[model samples]
Target: MRETLRVQLWPLPTLGVALAAVAGVGLPQLDARIQLDPPTWLKTYLFSGGPDAARSVLSAIAGSLVTVTALTFSLTVLTLQLASSQFSPRLLRTFTADRHVQATLALFLTTFTFALTVLRTVRTGKDEQTEFVPQISVTVALLLTLASLLALVLFLSHLARELRIETMMRSVHSATVHTIHRLLPQQQDTAGRDSAAGNASGATPEPPANALPLTVSASGFLTSMDEKALLRAAVEADAVVLIDRTPGDSLVAGTPVGVAWPRPGTHLSSEARARLVGRAAAAVSIGPERTDREDVAFGIRQLTDIATKALSPGINDPTTAVHALAHSSALLCELAGRDLGPRMLHDDQQRLRVVLRRPDLDELVTLAVAQPLRYGAGEPAVLARIAALLRELAWTAPPDRHPPIAGALARLRSTIDGQDLDDTEHVRLVELTRLAEEALAGRWPPGR
Candidate 1:
C-alpha cells in the first residue's frame, strides 16, 4: 500500500493540498477588503451604530477565495502539463545526462522554491482584497530565467568535457593500433633483411675458396646425411648451403649428408663424391623423427620477426626480443642437429632453470656470447665442436638436465676474464670454451 501511494498518488496530491491551504489562508482577508465586506463581530467591535463592515468583509473574502482557488487550480494544471511536456523521460535524460547540469538544475529549483515562498509572504498582506498577480508572475519569470542560465552553462561544460575525452581516447587507440601494425612487419623484415645482408656480406675471414651456394630441398638424399660431417665438408669446400630436413626424420649415427658445390670446371667423379659422402656419414647418432627442419626454421624465422617487432619502443621490453632470439637459437640448434633436448625446448622452463641455477646466463650474456661468435667466426672449428656437443647432448641427456648444461655454460662465461684479443681469436676462444662446457656436462668428447 505504501509502495503504491509513493509511486502513484503522493506527489501531485501533496502539492495540490499545499497550494489549496496557502490559498485558503491568504485569499480570504484580501477578498474581504476588495469586496468591502465586514463580519458582524468586527462591526460591533469597531463601530456599534455604523454601517455593516461584516457584510463588506465577508463579500471580499468570498470573492478572493474564488479567485485564488481558480488561479491556483489553473497554475497547478499548467505546471503539471509543462512538467510532462518539457521534463519527459527523454528530455530529462538529455538534460540531466550531464552530472554538472543536473547539479545546477537542482540548485536552481531549490532557489526558485525559496523565492516563491518569499513572494507569497510579501505580496499577501493583511488586506483580503490585496492582489499578488505581479509578484507571482515575477517569481515564476525569475525562476525560469535562473533555470535557463544554469542549464546553458552546465550543458556547454558537459559537451566540452565529453568531446575532449572522446577525442583523446580515439587518438590514443588509433596510435596504439597503428603502431602495433607498423612494428610487426617492420620487425620481421628488419631481422630477415639484416640476417640476409649479414650472410651476403660474407665478411668472415675463413678458408676454403671452392664454396658453392648449395640449396637442398627436403625430399632429397641430403636428409640422410650426417649433419656434422656435412657442415665440415661445406667448411672444407668453402661452400654455403641451405639444408632442408623434414620434421621428425630419425638421423642415423653415421650417414653422409649436405649438398655439395663442386668447383667450376672441376666436377667430381660420382665414385669420388660417393666416397666423400660415405665418410661424412660416419659421425653422429640420429634421433627419432618428430618435426621437419624446414618447418622448424620457418617457425624460428617467424618468432624472430615477432620478437623484433615486439621489442620496438613503446611496445614491449627489449629483453622480450632477446628472449625470443634465445628460443629461436635453441630451436635452430636442434633443427641443425644440435638439439638441447625436450626439457630445455620450452623458454619458460629453460629461463626458470637458468634463473635459479645459472643466473649469469641472462639474455645479455647470451647476446654478448652469440653476437661476436656468430658474426666473427664463419664456419670456425670451434663452432663445429660446439655443434657436435649440442648434438651429443640432445641424443644422450634427459630433458631435465638442461639446467645443468646452462649452469655449465654460465661457469664457462665467468671464466672468460675481459682480455684484449683480436675479434676472431676472441670469438674462437668463447666458442671453444662454451663447447667444452657442454661436452663436459653431457659426458662427450671430440669425435665421440
Candidate 2:
C-alpha cells in the first residue's frame, strides 16, 4: 500500500472568522466585570498566554504565523511567475505597464487583510460578559495597520530589485544588436549612397563615420555543471563567449557566444552554409540536455534557420502565413546583409529598433523581377501565361487569395513605373513583399 501525505493551507476567511469570534464573544466575556487589577505578568499570561491558557493564545499565534508565512510565500511565487510569463511580454508591450506598482499593491492588500484580522482578535477582552463586544483603541489599530503596510513595502522593494536585474539583462541584449548593426556594410549603405551623390554634385564629402563596435556582455548566476560544454559549443559556432572581468568571473550580458558570429565574407560557400545549418541543427538537438539553456538555444536555432534560408535557397518552410512574413523580414535583412533579425532574438526592444533601419526595397524588387525571367522563359503561350501567376504566388501573395497576387503585383507595378525611392516607399514595399512571402510560406516573426 502507498502512503499519501497532505498539507493544508489555512484559508484567509478562517482567520477573519476566528478574529471576529475572539473579539465579539470570547475576549469580551472573559474581561467583563472581573474588576481585578492583575499584575503585569498575570495580565500578560492571560492575554498573551502559554499553550495551556483557556483561550490558547499561543495556539492562535502559531496559527497566524503559519497562515501568514504560507500567504507570503504564495504571493511571492505568484508575482515572480507572473513577471516571467507570456502575459508579461504582452503587458510590457502595452504603454502603461508597471510591474512594480502592481506587485506592491498586491502585497500591501494581502498583508493589510491579515493585520486587520489579528488586530480584531487581540482587542477583544477575555471576560465572559464583555465577549459580546470588545473595545479597540484607535491608536492600536492605526499602529497595526501602519506596521503591516511598512513590512509589505519592504518585501516588495526586494522583489523589485530582482525584477530590475531581469530588465537589465533584456536591455543588454538590445544594446548588443544595436551596436553590431551599426558596424555592418548594409547599415552604411544609405550614408555611402548620399555621399556619392553629393560628390557627383561637386560637394565636399562628410567626415569618416564612426562604426559601432559589437560589444558582448552577460550577467547572471552561471554554475559549474555545463560551462565547458557551453564553451565548446560557442567555439564550434565561431562566436565569442565573454565573461565578466571581475573577481567572481560571472557571465556578462551582451556577451556574444561563438555561434552567433556572421558568415566570414560577402558570400558563403554552399558547403559552408550547409555546415552552419548543420551546426544550428545540432545545437537544437542537444539543447534539451539542460533546462536552463534550452529556451535560449531554441531561440538561437530558430534565428539561425531564418538567416540560413534568407541567404540560400531551400530553407523556407514556415507553418503559417504570419510566420512567413516575420521570417521574410528577417531574411530580407540577411539578404541585404543586415543584422536586424539577430538583434530581435537578443533583445525584446529590437522589435521596434529594427523598423528604424529601413530595408532595401531595390534588392527585394530585383528578386521579384528575376523570378519569372529565370523560371518561365520558353513554354506554350498559356503555360507561359500561368508563369505570371506562379511568379505572383512566389513574390506577391499566397495562392489562396481571391485575386491571388493581384493587389501586390499592382503595388509593385506602381513602384516600377517610376516612383522616386524614399525611405517610406522602400519600407512599404519591403513590408508588402514580406506579407506576400509569409502568406505563401506560413511563417511568423519572433515575439509576434
Candidate 3:
C-alpha cells in the first residue's frame, strides 16, 4: 500500500476525477441555494439565463473536450516513445514520474465531466411540463472549460520543452544528487559515536551455524522493505536478522535473501523461524523492474546507459558522454568524502536488530562510469573530461580514496600509451593525464 502510493502512476488523475464528480454533484446545489435566497450583492455575478444558451455552450464544450483529451494522450505517448528510442529506455521512468502529464489528463477529464454534468441539469422547453436550467452551474462549467483549454496549451508547450535533451539531463542530474544525499548517511552517524560504541562493545555478532535461511520465493527486483517493521519483528522474536539482498538486487526464487538467528545460545523452533520469515517477507516489496524510489543504483544505471549510448559507434556523440562522466564523477567524489553508513544497526538493548547491505565507494565508482570508460577511452574528448573529473575528485576526496579513481585514470593512461594518435593529440591527453596524476598525489600545479 505504501509503495503503491509512493510510486503512484495515476494519483493526480484519480483525485481529479473524484474532485470533478464532487463539483458536478455540489455546484448544482449552490445554484439552487442562490435561486431560493438570492443575495442582493451576489445577484450581479449570478447568471440569470435559460437552458437554450447554456446547454448549447455546454454541448460544445463536451464535444471539444473529448477530441482534445484523445489528441493530448496520443501526443504525450508519442513524445515518450521518441524519448525512449532516441535517448535511453531507462529514462522512461522519468515520464512515469512526471506530474504535469498526469495533470493534463486530469484537466481534460475534469472539463468534460463538468460540462456533461451541467448539461444534464439543464432542459429546454417541454410540451407539457416545466423546463429548468442551472444557470450558475453552467456558467461555472464554461469557465472551467476555458481554463482547461488554456491549461492544454501550456501542457503542449511544456511537453515540447521536456523532450529536449538538456532538460532531461538536468532532471537526471538533480535526481542523482538528491538520491546521494538521501541514501548516504553522514560520516558522524556511520563511523563516529554510534560506530565506535558498537565496535568497542562487540555488539554485532556473526550469524549462528544453525541460523535459519530465508529463501526469497518471488523473483524480481527487491525494491524496498520496511526497515523499522523488520527490526521490530526481530527484536520481538529475539532474533538477529541480516538481509543479503539490497533494494536494487535481483532475486531468484529459493535463493537465500536473508538470514535469521536466535539470540546467543537460544534456539527458536521451526514454527517460530517460519513465522519470522513470513513476517519479514511480508514487509518487503518486490517489483518486475527497478524504481528510483528505493533502488539506489537506478540513477547511476540511467546515467551510464546515456553515456554508453552517446559513445556507441552509431551515435558517436562524445560531448554527451563527457557530460555524463562529469555528473557521475561528481557523485562518486561526493560519496568519497562521506563514510558509507553503518551496515549493522543495534537496538536499545545493544543487540543487533537489523543488518543492511550497501555498495562501497569503490564499487559505486566502478558501477557508475566503468562502462563509459571502457567504451570511450579512445575518444580524446571523453578521456579529457574524465581526467578533469579525476583531478577534481583527487583534490576533494581524502588521500585513501584516490586509488579507486586514480586506478581508472591509470587505465586511461595505459590505453593512451598503446593508441595510435598523432603526437600533438597524444601530448594534450597526456597533459590532462599528468594533471590528474598530480592531483591524486596532492600536489599543486607548477605556478600555483
Candidate 4:
C-alpha cells in the first residue's frame, strides 16, 4: 500500500493527473460565462453552430480522444517493453519519470473528459425549448484536440530516438553521474590530519561487548539516513553512533543497523537507552528496492545489467559490452578523484557524533567492471575493449587511486587463454597490456 501511494504520487504522474482534473473541473465555468459574449470571429457558423453543432463537435472530440489516448498508451507500452528487453529493465523507471510522455497522456485525457462534461450541457432542442450553444466550450475543445494531435506527433518522435542504444547509455551515464555528485562530494586531502594522527595509525580497539545495537526494523536496502537527525539523537543521548550499514547495503530484520555507545566512563540509563534506540531506528529509511536517491551501487547495477545482457549467448554482442565498459570507466574516473570511504560526521557544535560506512573507490570500480569482465573473457575484442577502458580510467584518475586498476589488469591477464588467441590477436593483446601497465604505473603505483 505504501509503495502504491509512492508510485501514485511520483511527480510526473501526480502533476499530470492533477492538472488534467483541474482543467476538466474549471474550464466549463469559464465556458458558461465566456460564451455569452464570444468574439466576433466566433460568431460565424464555425463557432455559433447552435446546440446541434456543439454536440456534434463535443462528441467528435470525445470519441477521437478515446482512440488517440489508447494509441498513445499502446505505443508507450510497446516501446518500453522493447527497450527493456534489448537494453535494461531498470530504464523503465526513467521512462515513467519522463515529463514529455506524461504530459502527452495528460493532455489527451483532459481533452476527452472536458469534451464529455461540456457535451452534457448541450440541451439539444428538447420540447422546443430555446436552443443553446456553448460556443466557448466548443472552441476550446477544438483547440485542445489540435494541441493533443501536435503532442502525439512530438511524443512519437521522442520515443523513436530514445530507444537507441546510444541514447540509453547516455541516459544511464548522466543519472549515475548525478547520483555520484549527491552521495559522494569531493573531500579535502588528509595530509595535515594524517601528519597529526601518525601515532594513531593502528586501528582503534572495539567498543565494549555490551554496546547497544540498533536493530533494523525491517529487511530491505538501506536507501538513505538523516544525518542531522542521527546527530541530534546522539547529542541528546550523549552517545556516539557508528553506522553498520550504508546507503547501498542490504538489510535484514533483527540485524544491527548501527551501534550506539556512550563516551568512555559514561553509561546510558535504561530510559535513555530505549529512547536512543527508537531515534536511531527512526533516522534511517529502508525500501524493498534500492533507490537512485543516494545509492551509487544501484546505478552501477544498471550499467552491469546492460553489459550482462549484451554478453549473453543469445545476444553475443561484444560491441555493446564495450560501450558499457567505456562509460563505467568514465564514471569510475570521476569517483577516483573524489573523497571516498570517509567515516566521520560532526554536529554544529563541532563534536563528532556519527560515523558512517561508505564503499570506497576501489569497491565501486570492481562492482562496475566485475560482471562484464567475467562474461567477456572469451571474446578477444571484448578483452581489448576492456583494456582500453582500464587504461583510460587509470590515466584519468588521480595518482592515489590506481591499485584497483592494477588489480583489474592482473585479473584480466589471468582470464586470458593462449589456446584461444591467434598470432594476430596475441600481438594486439600485448599492445593493450602495455597500455594498461603504463596507465597504472606512469602516474599511479601498482598494488598500492
Candidate 5:
C-alpha cells in the first residue's frame, strides 16, 4: 500500500487540498470572531481592502491560480511523457515519485483552493448586513501566492536537473543499492552457504515424487512475498514449499510457479492440500508492474535499458552509455561483496519450510552485461566500459564468485575483438581485459 502510494501523484496533493480546505473554512470564522482592532504592526500585515476590493483581490488570485495550476499540471504531464519516451518507461516511477514536483503541485492547487474558499466569505453591505471580509484569510492567500511563485521557479530548476542522464542514473543506482542492502546483505562468513541457497538444514531434500505444483492464478509480475506467512503455512501443513519465481519474474495465469510437498513420511489430506495451495497462492503478491522493493535486478534492468537505448541508431550516444555503465558497475561491484542467495525460511526446529528463488551473481552479471554487449558491440567506448565493469567486479568478488566476472570478461574480449577499432582503442581494451585478469588473480595494478 505504501509503495503504491509513493509512485502516485495524487495522495500528497490530495492531502494538501484537504488541509487547505480545512484552513480555508476555519480561518474565515476566526476572522469573524476577532472583533478587537489590531495593533499597528499587525494591521500592516492584514488585508485592508473593503468588501468589494477584497472580492476583486480573491477573485483575481483564484483565477490566476487556476491558470497556474493548469500550467503546472501540463508541465508535469509533459515531463512524464518526455521521460517515458526518451528513457525507459520504467523510469516513469522515478519521475512520478519526485517529492519536489509533488509538493510544488500541491502548493499550487492548495493556494487555488484556498483562494476560492476564502472568496465566498467576502461580503458587501447588503440585505441590512454589515460589510465583511476575511482579512486574515486573504492575507494568507496573498502569502501563499508569493510562495507558489517561488516554488514554480525552484521546481523548474529541479525538473531540468532531473532530465539529465547523470541524475537519472544516480537516482536509479542509489535506489538499487538500497534494495541490495535490504534484500541481500553482506555475508560475514561462508557458513550456511548451501542452506542459504535452499538446501534443507539437515540434508538436501529429495524432490518429492508427489510434489503438488503451486499454480499462479493471475498474470503479472511477482512483486512481493509474505515469507513469514508462507513459512507459517508450510509449518502448519507439514510441507516444504519451494517458490521458483523471484519478485521481478513475470507470471502467467494458471501456470505452476513452484512446487510444494509433504515432508518425508507425511501425507497431505485433500483438505490440507487445498488449504496449502490457497495459502501459498495468497502469500505471493502480483502486480501489473515490477518494483525494486525486493528485486535488485529491476535497477540493473533500468540501467541496462538506458545504455542499450543510448546505443540505438536513433540516439547514437556512446558517452551516455558509458556513464550509465559506470553506475551499473557500482551496483554490480556492491552485489559481488554481498551474498546473493535464494532465501530459505525455517521452522522452530531448524527445518527448512519455504525456499524462495532469487538470482545469483552469474544471472545478475548476465542481466547487467548481456544486452549492452549485444547492442554496443561496434562501439569501442562501451566495450571498454564493459571491460572496466568486469575489472571492478573482479576486484570485489571472492574467488568462488570469480567465474562470472571472468566469463563476462571473456565475452567482453570476444566483443572487443569483433569491433573495428583503431590501434589505440584496441590496445586500451586489451589492457583493460588484462587488468581484469590480473584483478581476478589477486593482483592489483597501479593507477587506472
Candidate 6:
C-alpha cells in the first residue's frame, strides 16, 4: 500500500483539496465572529472592497485558477506521454512520483477551491440583510493566487529540467539506490554469510520427498512479501517454505510458485498443509506492475530499457546509452559487495523456516549488460563504458563474485571483436578489457 501510494499522483492533491475545503469554510465563520481595527498600511494588504467588488475579485480568482489548474494537468499529461515515448514506458512512474509536480498541482487546486469557497460567502445586501464580506478570507484567496502563480512558474522550470535525459537517469539511479538500501542489507555480519548450500552458494538442498507444491492465487508480478507471515506459517506447519519466485517475477494463477516440505522425520497432515497454503498466499502480494520496494532488478531493467532505447537506430544517441550504462554499472558494483542469493529466514529457535529467491550478481550483471551489448555493439564509446563498468565491479567484488564480471567482460570482448572498428578504437577497447582483467586479478594501476 505504501509503495502504491508513493508512485501515485492523487494522494497529495487530494489531501490539499480537503484541507483547502476546511479552511475555506471555517475561516469565513471566524472572520464573521472576530472584528478588528487595522492600520492604514495593514488595510492596504487586506481586502478593502465592498461586497460587489469582493464578489468580482473572488469570481475572477476562482475562474482564472480553474484555467490554470487545467493547464497544469494538461502539461503533466503531456510530459508523461513524451517520457513514455522517448525513454521507456517504465519511466512514467518516475515523473508521476515527483513530489514537486504533485505539490504544484496541489497548490493550484487548493487555490481554486479556496477562491470558489470564499466567493460564495460574499453577500451584497439583499432581503433586508446586512451586507457581509469575509475580508480575511478574500485576502487569503489573493495571497494563495499569488503563490499559485509563483508555483506555476517554478513548475514550468522544473518540468524542463526533468525532460533532460541526464536528469531522468539520475532520478532513476537515486530511487533505485534507496530501494537497494531498504531491501538488500550489507553482508557485514557473519550471520549474513550463512547462505543455504546448493541454494545460492553451496550445494542445493533438496526438498523432502513429500514436499507439497504451493500455487499462486493470482496472476501478476510478485511485488513483495511479508517475511514474518511466511515464517509463522512455516513454523506452524513445521516445515520449510521455499519461494521459487522473487519480486519482479511474473506469477500465474494456479501455478506453483514454491514448495513446502515438512521438517525431517516429521509427518505432514492435510489440514496443516491447507492452512499453510492459505497463509502463505496471503503473505505474498502480486501486482500488475513491478515496484522497486523489494525488486532490485526492476531498477536495472529500467536502466537497461533506457540504454537500449537510446541505442535504437531511430535515436542513435550513443552518449545517452553510455550514461545509462554508467548508472547500471554503479548499481551492479553496489550489488557486488552485498549478498545476491536466496534470503533465508529463521524462526526464534534458529531453524531456517523460509527461503526466498533473489536475483544473484550474475543475473543482474547480464540484465544490465546484455541488451546494451546487443544494441550498441558497433559503438566504441558504448563498448568502452561497458568495459569500465566491469572493471569497477571487479574492483569491489570478492574472488567468488568475479566470475559474473568475467563472463560479462568476455562477452564485451566478443562484441568488440565483431565490431568493424578502426585500429584506434579496437586498441582502446583492448586496453580497457586488459584493465578489467587486471582488476579481477587483484592488481590495480598495472605496475602499482
lDDT of 3 by residue, 168-204 (tens): 8778877877876776665545545463123222333
In lDDT terms, which candidate is top? 6
lDDT of each: 0.36, 0.33, 0.76, 0.76, 0.87, 0.87
Where model 1 places Cα greater than 4 Å from the true spot, the runs are 1-295, 310-316, 322-326, 329-439, 443-448
lDDT for each residue of candidate 2 in 304-333, tens digit (9 for 90 to 100): 222223223342222221232233333333
Candidate 6 regions exceeding 4 Å error are 36-44, 190-204, 446-448
Judge candidate 4 against the unseen true structure and give its global Cα lDDT, from 0 to 1.
0.76
Clashes of each: 35, 39, 0, 0, 0, 4
**C-alpha RMSD of candidate 3:** 2.9
Per-model TM-score versus the true fold? 0.19, 0.23, 0.90, 0.88, 0.95, 0.94
Can you write out model 6's per-residue Cα lDDT over 1-448, one digit (the tens) per residue? 8878888999999999999999999999987875355456767677888999999998899899899989999999999999998899999999989999999999988998998988888788998877889998999999999999999999999999999989998988988888888777675542534333212233335787668988889999999988888988999999999998889999999998899999888866989989999999999999999888888898899999999999999988989899999999899888887767677776766677788888998899999999999999989999999999999999998998998889999999989998899999999999999999999998877522
Q: Candidate 1: what lDDT?
A: 0.36
* Clashing residue pairs, backbone N/CA/C < 3 A, model 3: none
For residues 1-448, could you state the per-residue lDDT of candidate 5 as single tens digits? Answer: 8889999999999999999999999999999888366567878789988998888988888899889888888888998898777778899999898999999989988998899899888889899887888899999999999999999899889988998888999999999999988777565543554443333324335557678998878999999999878988899999999888898999998898889998888899999989988988998999999999888899999998999889989989999889988888999888888766666777777777888877889998999899999999988888888888888888888899998888888888888888889999899889989998999999889635
Candidate that beats the other on TM-score, 2 or 5, i.e. the better one: 5
Candidate 4 residue pairs in clash (backbone atoms < 3 Å): none
- Residue pairs with backbone atoms closer than 3 Å in model 5 (clashes): none
- Higher-scoring candidate on TM-score, 1 or 5: 5
